[model samples]
Target chain A: MAFQILLNIAIAFIWMLLKNNFTGVEFAIGYIVGLLLLFVLRRFLNFDFYFRRVIAVFKLIVLFIYKLILANIDVIKIVLSPKLNIKPGIIAVPTKLKTEWEVTLLSCLISLTPGTLSMNFSEDGKTIYVHAIHVPDKNEAIKEIHNSFEKAILEVTK
Target chain B: MTEIVVSILILLGGAFSILGSIGIVRFPDVYGRLHAATKSATLGVICIIIGTFLYFLLVQELFIGKLLLTILFVFMTAPVVGFMVSKSAYNVGVKLWDQSIQDDLGKAIKKAEKKARQ
Candidate 1:
């Protein structure tokens, strides 16, 4: 709990430094105030497992950075193609994960990837429907989501 | 030199956004158009935010935190919005063009119906 608060303060400091705003005194006072508010909220909400969630968020940041670089390359290929060589369609990808947060993260990841967008999820939460922009192979798309994003999400949440 | 790069990125981002808007107008169906709108528009906004960050970084020798915050916010929100729009469009009975192959959702619906009756 204390560790999480410290981590949040460190992150806030870095963010403030990057922004080139706030002097030393200002940063210290602001951080302490923010940390107090956060701690109060956490206690009021009875969020005992916040540390694990924070770690998961950190992992997600790293994963997102890696995906962002790959997505840029994919989008470049998409833009430069002479013919709009796209076989666009929506695919119903089955979700093996159970939690709402895990499912939502998977959908967001699919959408973030250059060639894919999460179209919908079934009411029962059994499947996610995604739209692929340039699906040369349908099976490949489904497999990618199932193995890549969903697999990572399962690891983080469960 | 830094200013030149920033200008170029800004121009490119604007161009991508314009192309995305054009796609929304030109694409045949709701799904197809949403694809264009979501992908290009999201990328466009990202690029613009990145360019702005770079501009500030070059001038001030520090990153702008809000740029990352903007990226995070867009990354979170854009897809959910896109998903909602597409789902609503589909639910409202927007039909795909004749050329579209493999209606997987339709097949799934049929299979579910068959199972439900039995």
Candidate 2:
């Protein structure tokens, strides 16, 4: 991962020198160009892992932003409503995520959502404790986490 | 042409900021307020940053690096800071809403205390 990042930065700087523009748009374009170059030269450069990781991170960010919009709208609705009909409850979500970085990413994603907050890990770290503001059903909540946040994190990380 | 889009973005950013502000003020307790403060407020800031970036890009014809950096920094840090603040709050027993239906952490804290005592 570290080596790939250095390679990417190196490519970006090379791109900057080639393009003769150091602006953000140029930098972004250069980055994409660098990414494509890496991808095309994947076998030669042995940068397949870096290439995949970059793409995965991009997809995760897109997914997070899309969900973030929904989360904002959902929270705004709940807040603007007459009766604060929130069924706030804590649920234990079993996680396949093991490593500290992945777990931290997962918890931060969970916490960023509108109504949910990650509270604690179980004694074993197998189960994550989450508090949702309107958890009408525990199973549904768990499934949602599994399908979206956990799945996205899994794809981005190892 | 670009003016219309920039105006729309600015308005949307303002609206998000307003909505989040209302939520922070009106939401019941620390936990509920956090719901607004973290998610909505962060989104609000992002929207504003994006709007500012576009404005700088389109109007001034200067692609400033600092605005982009600010957006990137906020994206990386806001959720993290929010998570830490709320986690510490719960740990130190800042009250959840009166209507909160679960106390999983409370039980866990109690169990840990009992284990520590023994």
Provide C-alpha RMSD values for all models, in order: 7.0, 3.5
- Specify the poorest-scoring 10-residue window by lDDT in model 2 chain A: A45-54
Give Cα-based local distance difference scores for all models.
0.73, 0.81
lDDT of 2 by residue, A124-158 (tens): 77878887889878889889999998888888776
Give each candidate's interface RMSD in Å. 2.5, 1.5
Off by over 4 Å in 2: A1-49, A122-125
User: Which prediction has the highest lDDT against the true structure?
Assistant: 2
Off by over 4 Å in 1: A1-59, A62-83, B1-5, B53-69, B111-118
State, as a TM-score between 0 and 1, how close model 1 is to the true structure: 0.69
> Which 10-residue span in candidate 2 chain B carries the lowest summed lDDT?
B78-87
Q: What does the i-RMS of model 1 come to?
A: 2.5
Q: Please write out the lDDT profile of model 1 over residues A1-158, one tens digit for every residue.
A: 67767766886687577668878775776676666666666756655645556677677778776775566556555555565555677678888888887788788777777567787777698888777666667888788777767766765766
Cα-based TM-score, every candidate? 0.69, 0.83
Candidate 2 Cα deviation (angstroms), residue A17 = 10
